[model samples]
Target: MIQQGISPRPEAQIFDADTHLGSNTFSIGPSRTSDGSTFLAVNSHQPWEGAVTWYEAHFHSEQGLDMTGGLFPGSPMILVGHNRNLRWSFTVNHPDLVDTYVLEINPDNPNQYLFNGEWLDLEVRQAPIKVKLLGNLSWTVKQEVLWSVYGPVVRQDHGTYAIRYAGMGLVDIWEQVYRLNKATNFKEWQSAMRQGGFASFNVGYADREGNIYYLYNADLPIRTEGYDWSLYLPGDTSETLWTQYLPFDDLPQVLNPAAGFTQNSNSSPFQTTLDPDNPHPDDYSPTLGIETQMSNRALRALELLGSDESITFEEFILYKYDMTYWADSDVPRMVQMILDAPTPQDADLLDGIEILRDWDYDADPESIGATIAILTLYDLARTSKSFLGSRLVGGEFTSEEVLDSYQRTVESMLEHFGRVDVPWGDINRLIRGNVDLGLGGGPDLLHAVGG
Candidate 1:
């Protein structure tokens, strides 16, 4: 078994950081376009500067590989982009691929754990890590790493835990990207996907031949029923150990839906397209842990693209740049919650609430309401774990928390700008080398921003 390198830390320290990895992708087939031409918008939202930031490049080879797209540093092939025959983009998808097991350690031996009816010894190794100290000084530190039958092991004060995740030892991801880069047709592209190299991503594809596809691709483990996979499993039993993955064909996918378009904004897979064509949530196993929440971006996409029968290229581009949050989205709902709360006596808080009440739900640069809403929500997301996770998963928030966040927003605005009626663009800016531009969109909108 391959040993996964995991740093030992307290269980409480492990938090959900995947909410920031958001992307938006959509494909329109010939039936949905005015000129009978296919359209694809490959938009991925990522940090402006980081290790995971995107770098655009073009790759060509005499071996029939010619593609242009974005990739991270050190990536051998383009992760999402278009070849000559077809274009595809990737949006991050959340599936229950990782599981934690609470191990029953042997009473007498710290290096042994109970498995089935036997006490099995753990695989231990020393991992050397280099640390940089001053300018030219460094230190080498050796850390003890342990591996159990389930996977990497971490010993805590309470008990020992093992982590098992998809693509634990798989190394063919680059090869799969290479194959996707060279595929000339839908059949070839589907064959490449069938290789099952990608662990998680919602793929959006549009071809020159008028074919469009959306796939909720994941290497979901064939977990047994009758157990809550979301909770920690009993490590002492082999029955909780899953060793097989669901087949590629078993995954949720849509090919050339009659609705004429497909979209994913890190939302639920069951609502990828129109009602009759979308994948049913009941068709999949509950152990898959598929997301059932609809993001604001996804809701806007459905509202814009679904209502249009023949979309022109210009209209498609305009829709992609949509800055309005849907009426039923969480943003409007949260705004209402604030309005319905008990009226605050403070003048600044009252003004802030009025600004939000009278303002339209558009994230335009000139919108003053968006300035307050986005800043307040973004601050809440940074400080509260529940708020951050709930933004994507559709979790509930208490009135106290919402009112407190608004109060903080008023204080912050007064401290920084001396007013709460500042324009959205003035507060939300995109600064680069010699170019500081005003931005129009807030988080989770069609034209999304991290702020």
Candidate 2:
């Protein structure tokens, strides 16, 4: 079926256009740190300027509320940050909390739909959308909105569809975040989380009490069995309607694991920590639609944080700024694919391949290799039909595509800089008013910077 307002495209080709929008948050417990002090890093990768851009702020009140962290424009409460006693941060989580159903509309009565062997009238209402025509001039249009037993109804060209999503009418998110900001300990924080107002996020929390926690927090709908929730479901049955959510206790979480650390880089909750501590896929129902993909940031986090036995605060800070891709990650694999392909006769293409071959997989500002590899990968991510996101999992690029991307990178570099060995910093720059600086870290790295 055609998605409303979106043009027809390959399902796999659908991706988040805001590639820079991701986050990395980790909590280190006392047992894993050198000084026996708990540490938490609250890092969110957001656009530098937008309505959702982060602004640092501290909120204080007489009713035992004190928080300092980042929040969106006009947001009264902090979305991710720390208080005096504890700290917590959020990273995006992928859970199937929404489902679309193909509704069987009655041709005899257009507003009536077939459900449970009975004809049900759709709830129709008028929604007013105000459009600004010019300065201080606005036009208000009343649009017809429909609702079904599932949720909102969308009339598509192919058929009528109803979408059901978690937290449909819940509007207490500010209250929950306020409770979280006022929480002074783990129990209080978890109690705040039990409000179940947040729809989806991977929460990384640490407190002065040496307690660390990682929660794959979501208001997940309890769906029926034997139906593929990923695809459109039959709307003509009550079985497809999910009216309840899983209890907050059933959500995947890790509390002060023996591993002493927990992280989420928009990856699978099953890989939040070491195997014994991480959530098991078998425990959750498949209808929940929890993702299983691991991002390169997640893999590198596991490598760096898992290997270090006792991490100092300095080391923790250093690890947070790491820019190297993992050895087994897709970047090196793609580089190898280019090398193993039939050698191109063009000298510029050959030079690009040699630069990639001799280069280390680090997105350092001064590194010439990163310039070639990252530019080519960015091009591939834009042009390749199979590419999805920074994770680069389940996507395939043929040798021809890889070579063509590399050749394009070489040509662009030659055209602009007169050489293929330009430093990454020269191109990937950070500019402000009268302040221009070179920045390190390419996309998907620990210190990710999207140029």
All candidates' lDDT scores?
0.86, 0.86
Model 1, runs deviating above 4 Å: 1-18, 128-141, 342-350, 382-385, 389-393
RMSD of 2: 3.0
The total number of steric clashes, by the backbone 3 Å criterion, in model 1 comes to 0
Q: Model 1: per-residue lDDT, tens digit, 3-25?
A: 12222332332224355557899
Q: Count the clashes in each prediction.
A: 0, 0
TM-score of each: 0.91, 0.94
> lDDT of model 2 at residue 29?
91
Model 2: which residue pairs collide?
none
